[model samples]
Target: MKFNEWTIKDHYPEMALQDIQPISLRAYSLLNRNISALGPNEGAINLLGALEMLEALDYHFINFTQIEKGESPINQKHEAVAYLNRLGQLYFFTKSRFTKKYIPDSESHMPKVIEFISIRHKNTAHRSLDSPQKEPDEYRDRQAFTFLGATTRKFLGNEQYVFPNYNKDTNETEWFYFTPAIDHPIIMEQSYNLIEKIIKELLNNL
Candidate 1:
C-alpha cells in the first residue's frame, strides 16, 4: 500500500489477455517486494503484514453471465460463487503449465478458498475494522489460512477460533491480537515465489 508502487508505471504487468481478472492483477500491483522498509517488525500487522496484506486484497467474484448492478443478497452471492468457482478451476485447482500437468489433489478445497475470498473481501477489505458486526465465517477462512501457510516452507500446525465471555459486556474490541506462526518468515519467502510464478504466467503469451 505504498505510493511508489502505483507511481512507477513499469511496475505494472501488462494484461495482454482479456481473460485475466482485474482484481488479481491489482492484488499483485499492491505487493511490497522489499521488507527492508519495515524496520523492526514487532506487531501483528507488521509481523504477518505480508500474509494479511495479500489476504486483504479485494477479490471480487465477478460473473459476467449473471451481471447484477444492484440486486438482492442471494443473487449476488450465487453469481459470485459460480464465477469464482470457474476461475479457481482454471487457475488454481488444475496445475498445468503449457504442457506438464500437475493435478492439485484428490481433496482440493478450492470452493472454500473462493468462499473465503468472498467473506474476507466483504468483512475485511471492503469495510473498516471499527464496524462492530464482523461476518462470522472463521471456519470458512481456515482452509485459506491453512493452504497459504502450508504452501510455504517450514510451518507448524495450529487451529484458530473466536469466542467471548460476557455479562453482555467487554467494551468494544478497540484492539485485537493474534500470534503469528513461528515459520512466518518462510511464509513471506514462499509468497515471493508464488508472486513471481503468477506474474509470469498471467502475462502476454506473445
Candidate 2:
C-alpha cells in the first residue's frame, strides 16, 4: 500500500475510537497521516536513522510499546514483539522507497546491488547466527533477534542489537509492526511530526 493511505489503526486495532477518547484518537490519526506522508525520496530519511531519531525525541517515543492495550498477550513480551515486528516492516517499506529513488537503474548496478545485498545478509546473520547456549534467556534473546527492530530493541532491554542491513536482500522474517492501539494518541502525532521533520532535513542534504 502507498504511504499516504496507511493508518495506525490498520496495524494497531487495540486503539480504536471506542478504546481511546475521541480527542486523543483524532490527535493520533492526524499524527499518523503526517508521518505516512514522509516518503524516503521526498526527504531521504532512511529507516534505521529515522527510527532511532524518533526514539530519542522523548520518553513517550521510547516507551510507546509499553502502553496498556487492554488485550490478551499484553505483557512486555507481546509488546516488544509487536513493536519490533511492525518497526521492521516499516524499515523494509521505507527502504524500498530509498532503493527506488537512489538505485533506480538496478540492472546497470547489478554488481553494486549484489555487494550491498551480501553486506546486508552478513549483518543480519551476524546478529542472528545460531547461539551457543541453550538456556531459556538465550532463546529469548534469539527470538528477540528475529522479532525486534533496532528501535524496539532498546525498549526491550537489549541495546546491543544493531541495524545490520547493508545490502537489503534478506527476507527470512515477516511480521506486522505498528502502533499498539488507539489509546496512545500522542504517539501518532509525535511520529508524524518527527517523520516530516526528518524527511525535510534529509532532502535538504540530498
Candidate 3:
C-alpha cells in the first residue's frame, strides 16, 4: 500500500478520537501537505522524520512479504536487510523523541529491538570484521568465502566458515557464527504494534 493510504485509524481505531486524533491528523497533514504552520521548527523536523521512517518501515515490510510469498531465498535476504534497516531507524527515532519514561529501561521489547538494530549496524551499516571480543557470540569468528571459479567443482552459493574457539576458563565455546537470522513476518508484525504504541504515546505527549 502507498504511504498516504497508511492511515493511523485503520491500524489503531482507539486513536481515532480526542487528543490523539488531532495530533495524528496534524502530523499527517504536515507530512502529506507540507503545511506551513508545522514547519520551520525542531518538533516539525523530528515529527516528519518519524513519519517518513514509519512509511519506510511499511514499504520494506510489504516488499519482504511479497518476496517471501514468491519463495525466493536470495531476494528475501536482501529485503530482510532493507526491512531491518528501516526498523532500526524508526526505533532510534522513537527513542530520540521520547524520554526514558516513555521507553523505560525495563521494556520487554527493548532486547529484540536492540538485536534488530545491532544486526543492521554490524552487518550492513558499518560492516564489522566479526571480532570475537567485540562482536556477539553468534556473530564471532566469521569468514566469507566465495567459490566463483573452480576448475574441478562447482558450489551453489558462497560459504561463511565459522571457527568456534573453546574457552577452557568458561567451559564453553567462545567463538561462533550464524547468518543473521530474523523471522521477517513476525518481526514486522511486532514492529507495527510498536509503531502504534509510539504514535499513541507521542500524540499524548503533544
Candidate 4:
C-alpha cells in the first residue's frame, strides 16, 4: 500500500537470489503515478483502485516470505512459491480489463504472466548453472509453480479458478481469469477515496 517503500522483495519470495525485474518496477511506478495524477476521473479512479488492489495482493506475496522459520529450507521456499502463484492472478484481471479498453483487438492484450515467470526462471536457472553439463533442478521449477499458484488464488476465487467460464459472459469478453488459489482483499474505503480525488480534480479542471 505504501508505494514509496515498495520493492519486489515484498512480492516474490522464491526469487530471493535476485532483485525485482526492472520492467515490473517501472510498471508499478507508472501505475502509481497515473493513479495519483488522474485520481479525479471517475473511470480512471476505478481503474486505479483495481490497480492498487492488484499491487497490494502482489506485495503481500513478497511480505509472506519475510516470515522466518525453523522449517526445512526446501519447505519454506516451496510454501513461498505457492503463495506467489496465487498472487499472480491479479495481473490476469488487470491485463484483461486494460487490454479490452485500450487494445481491444490485440490478441496478446492479456499480459503474458506465465511467460514472464518462465523467463525469470530460465534466466535465474541459467545464471546459477555452472556449465553446459549442468542444468537447473526440476524442484526449482516446482517452486516457481508454487508461487504462481499462490498468485492465482489471491486474485481469483475457487469457482473461477476451477472453471473460468462458470460466471463469465459469453461472446467477446475483455475479462479473463486464472486459477483461484489466492485471496485478494478489496479495499473499498481506499478505492472510494481515490475515486473522490479523481472526480474532484476533473471537475476543477472543467
Best by lDDT: 3
Candidate 1 overall Cα lDDT vs. reference?
0.31
lDDT of 2 at 47: 37
Across 1-206, the per-residue lDDT of candidate 3 in tens digits comes to: 22333323233334432233223333453343322322232344545566666566556655645653447455545555566677677667646734234555423554456545544555444333433344444433231111111111212342221223434467564433222223443444444444445444544554
Query: Candidates sorted by TM-score, descending order?
Result: 3, 4, 2, 1
* Shift in Å, residue 143, candidate 3: 5.2
What's the true lDDT of residue 136 in model 4?
35
TM-score of 2: 0.27
Q: Give the per-residue lDDT digits (tens) of candidate 1, residues 32-80.
A: 3322232232221322333333333223322322445555444533333
Best by TM-score: 3
Residue 202 lDDT in model 4? 47
Q: How far does residue 86 in candidate 4 sit from its true spot (Å)?
A: 4.1
**Candidate 2 lDDT, tens digit per residue, 30-142?**
34544544433343235334444334323233354445566332244444333444434333433455644533442232232232332233333234344322224433354
Better by lDDT, candidate 3 or 1: 3
TM-score of 1: 0.24
User: Where does candidate 3 stray beyond 4 Å?
Assistant: 1-44, 68-72, 97-102, 105-111, 130-206
